[model samples]
Target: MEYLSNWAKNIVYYILFVKLISHLIPSGNMSKYIKLFTGVILIIVVMEPILSLPNMEQKIKSNILNMENIIAHKDFQSQSKTYSKVNDQLAINLYKKQVEEHIRKLVRGEDVEVSSINIKINEEEGKNFGEVVSIDMKVRKKNSSNDLSIEKIKIGADSTAYNITAEDIIIVKNIKIALRGFYNISPDNMNISVSQ
Candidate 1:
């Protein structure tokens, strides 16, 4: 728009200059030549603005390209943030599933049916195994012979299912000793429960 206004101003200036020169020239063939020369100058004045367009276009194009680059960078950053959140959630879910699987293996080859496993994790600490806050397990047996339910309740005995009893426990001097270990927390910080 500025270029257009400048072009108009240049045209007005050239017209005034040509008019002033016309008055100074004498009436003869030389005057005709002067008039013709002024006409050529008028043509040059009209075309000057149009000829300088490529340089102006280059600057405008450069600004447009810069804006596009900025928009692309911002879009990438937004996508990365979204993906990071999704990835974190997926990691937590996968870890929980793995823990459930490990508990199932603890039952070994038996008739016990695991109902559900609920574990509450600390989101602030991320999905690290040490960040586990609590775990609740529900399980039952199909039959007495294929189960260790009654043995688990026996007054002074460790029970077995499928001839299996895997542990490091010792009940001596009326002080029941069990080795229950977990990461990222002290013994007092962990909460665990199992029910049949």
Candidate 2:
């Protein structure tokens, strides 16, 4: 091929030039150093074709861009996963608060004051995720004196007396039943306490 012939001619011309230079210079330490420098130049000339191969620059640039894109994509995926976890946690917290408020309302309907309510739900991802796991509630009966009713005079022996403990048990049972029916939670998972 014409290209191969030109390359061979170039090599021949470089060798002739080096030989002429060496002949003009006397054999000495300086001559060896010059030969070494010329040898390095000869290597560069010999590798010129391969080094200057077509699309080499484009290939290098493309490889760099591909690496950059891969890194960027990995970073984006990591960020998205982090954001998703945070969002899921936020949603879970909001749901817990809403369920607590609903429980408070249900307890209030029984003429009880809710001191605290904690509803635990499944946070893991699965079919049972977000299901209520347990509930802990602390409540107290509302003050009856606020009713402003007149005291009745006892004309005879009382047939029945009010028991606060019994009332509290009834309130707790009612709360458990309400929660079980509405939220499908088991009474075993509920810890309800009525405090004086």
Prediction-by-prediction clash tally: 0, 0
Give the Å error, residue 170, model 1.
16
List lDDT for all candidates, in order: 0.60, 0.85
Cα deviation at 68, candidate 1, in Å, is 0.8
Q: Give the true-structure RMSD of model 1.
A: 8.8
| TM-score for each of the candidates | 0.54, 0.65
lDDT of 1 by residue, 35-123 (tens): 78988988889889767889979998999999999999999999999999899889988887886676556543343556776766677
Task: Please report the TM-score between candidate 2 and the true structure.
Answer: 0.65
Cα-lDDT of candidate 2: 0.85
The numbered model that scores best in TM-score is 2
Model 1 spans > 4 angstroms off: 1-20, 27-51, 107-111, 125-130, 146-180, 183-196
Task: Name the lDDT value of residue 97 in candidate 1.
Answer: 85
Q: Write candidate 2's Cα lDDT for 8-110 as tens digits.
A: 8879988988989888888888987988988987997798778677656787899999999999999999999999999999999999999888888888888
Error of 2 at 161 (Å): 23
Clashing pairs in 2: none
The deviation in Å at residue 112 for candidate 2 is: 1.2
